[model samples]
Target: MVKKQDQVTHNAKPTAVESRGGKSTIAIKGTFPEKYFAKKATMTITPAIKNYNGEIKQLTPIDFQGEKADGKGQIINYKEGSGFNSVQNIPYDPAFGKSILVLNSTVKKGEKEIKLNEKEIGEVNMSTKRQDIDPKLVYKNQTSDGTNYYFSEHNYIPNNLVVKTATIFFDFNSDKLNWNLPFNQKEENKQALSELFPFLMDYDSIQSIDIEGWASPEGELRRNQQLSNNRSLVGKKWFEKELESYLKKQSKETKSFMKRLTYKLYDKGEDWDGFINALKNANIEDKDKIINVIQSQATKIQKEQQIQNMIAIYDEIDQKILPCLRRSYFKISCVENLRTDEEIMRLVNISPDSLTKNELLYAASLTNDMEMKKKIFSKAIELHPEDYRGYNDLACIKVAEGKTDEAKKLFENANVLKSNNDVVLNNLGIMSYQDKDYGKSEKYFNESQKAGMDQSKNLALVKDTIYTIDYQTKPDIEETANDDKTKKQKSEDD
Candidate 1:
């Protein structure tokens, strides 16, 4: 908006606002008319903008002194006025759309002062604010875009190898695993055992099963050794029986997991460490003396007698302490059954419902085709409507299509599903930016960054609008904006 009044002539009348040198600027260039200045007169020129809400933003004023006037100001000649070029950068605000720019001038000579009529520079055009940043998406592995921008994605399952451990306990002086005993009756043991079949049936490939059995040092060393070995053998046999039963129930098409399974059995006889730890932890009568007698005694028979004597003195050692020493442990190593890229792509279109949510999202990520991504995301939302990932990712697709209205609705839906989510908050920020609501967009980006998604780049982009001037200043230029700055700004973007 650079058109000048009848009294003023401008270098150029820019129709649109532009971003240059990473700053949003509105530059005006012109010169005062010759013989316009009085010998003892001082003039003040002010530029301002009237926004959509009728609020005015006044820029820093420029001053000029007459030849007879004192002070360090641009001395205007009485015969020939000075040239000027001003570049005033202001952050982009929502209300800046269709704003008007005006110049105010005043002159003071002797005891008299005159206020000139307001000059319309022109309507400031905000067309340069329109930009497509191509916002990064959600639900995937977050990556950097060379400029420290976090590009969020959803296909985060890099590897599915897992080592799961489950524990089962036994009864006092028993080689058998008693299901009714409180130790053995824990739901975790049953849950852990039950989980193995399904993983073996389809989900994962069972690599190895490590089983360990331990017995308390209450019996003879040789007897405890045999007991530990028998208990571990029982655990292996029971697991194999459970696998066989599951195999009978499943379809023959499923792979035979037993053939793939490798068993490593360890019989840890006489848990002396367990006994000492239990004794140290227990709050019992003569606790110190009992531990000393057990740990320092010479013979196993003597230690057993001392333990028996302590058991008589305190039932805590026999009931609560000893039960924990006898136990069976298992470690199951498994690798997830991952489908190939070709398989996922074929199944995504043919029978999408059969694919899992992660597989569908991964399928969408595999292709550069937007239409394919749209189809995959559509199915993801359809099959898993409750998941926010599908909604957010589908909205990103709509945004890429320039379907802002549709994208906004989907983004809102994602917010509803997972309130204050970082990825959704960032997308919402972009929506606000598109709607010309920079203030609201800033708040959302700040929240997004705080919530773990980095939106700093977006924040700076929204706040700083760059402006550049390719044309030279006009003959009417009265003042340059940055007189102290000798070097001109040339942006890489220009």
Candidate 2:
């Protein structure tokens, strides 16, 4: 009976060992059981791959013979057994993604021979090629040892700036909606409002709509003060009515989530500052004097009085400037889960520019396709170059794909865009851990834990994970499975 091979290689634990220069190898080394071979028997051993498709491909075979056997090959001492080492690599093949390494052997003496059952040695899985890199990232930076290692976990969710804003003006002292007002009719305002309704319809995504009403400083103090308050109410009422009407036309399913729309109103009374700003920019008569008069006035009444004086005196300030100051500004900020994954994916592909940096990052999570995520992150980097997420994220992809050189560049770029960012720093730390650079790994992990993005790197990560044999072990642990090392250890002992 053949003794089970002692697997010393940790390559069995998966970190996605990428093939280099078109070469892929599976090596085997183990001790033959003491006296397992017959005194005059000779044996031949061959290793093979039983692939996912149920096909077997045989590799080169090596021969061993007992001391008394008529063979001129590696001799097996029948009393002590023996340790053998063999490494066989082939050109990389995608079909080898999910396969089994098995041993095939024949024991022969004289004209009689016996073929043994193929025994599974280990599994070969290349599925990690689809890894998002950081979902398992390779820290791109290199230490004193070498530039190889991977680190990443799918823990962080990017925070997005979901709020969008627009301003629509009202006539001074009026609380009514002004359809024809130029500020209300501005194309940009229309564009802003255009997106507002869809969010309101999906009301769940809409966090809140805040409308702030303002009045230019003029007329009776109390009246002008109350004007903004009334304007806010008027705008609120209009949205309530508009949304109600819109919901009335929706199906019950669509209407179910539209039960209520949250509206917060604010009265930012007396745009005296706005009036002053208008005064400075105005080329009308007594611009400087008007500014002086308004600034000199201590009380709101006096300021209102000066504004009235100016209104009565300068039609340019009264008709043109005051109208701009008296307006309602509204903002609709969305919640974190604003868009559906499908919508985000569509936007990522069709109009990535339309997405915020956070949306782009989150969109990468919408699909399992690595290339799609790379596309999304690339767009984020292009549109929001100042942001670190894009660089850190794309670099992670690079690392997972065994493109450490590219990963290094991107992570370095991320470090530059935002120094000591927890997510990026922690990734660097994990890379260090992978490379057994414990000190550097801890420093980075601690910096990340105490730094931003609310991440905490576990210093005991490798030790803790190394115990699992999780379809794999830590890279350090995985090294134990190396055939060459196992073979060398025996050779050294002998």
Residue-wise lDDT of candidate 1 within 348-438, one digit each (tens)? 8899988877788888878889898888888888899998888888888888788989988988898899887887888888788878788
Off by over 4 Å in 1: 1-132, 136-139, 142-159, 162-165, 216-227, 241-261, 269-322, 415-421, 439-452, 459-494
Scored against the true structure, residue 420 in model 2 reaches a CA lDDT of: 66
Residue range 1-494, candidate 2, lDDT tens digits: 43433321212232225543454555567577675767787878787767778987778887888888898668978778878777776444567656676777787888998787656667654432211123333332323222233322333343334777767678767888887987778788778765666565543456778998888877776786688898888877776666666656664444555455578899988887787787788888778987888889888788878777777878998778888878777788776555666777788778888876666776776667879878877887889888777888888777768786787788878888888676777777666665566678678778876875333325544323211111322343346668678899999999
Score candidate 1 by TM-score against the native. 0.64
RMSD of every candidate to native, in Å, equals: 9.6, 20.5
Off by over 4 Å in 2: 1-161, 202-205, 248-258, 280-289, 338-494
Highest TM-score against the true fold, candidate:
1
Error of 1 at 229 (Å): 2.5
Give candidate 2's error at residue 360 in angstroms: 8.4
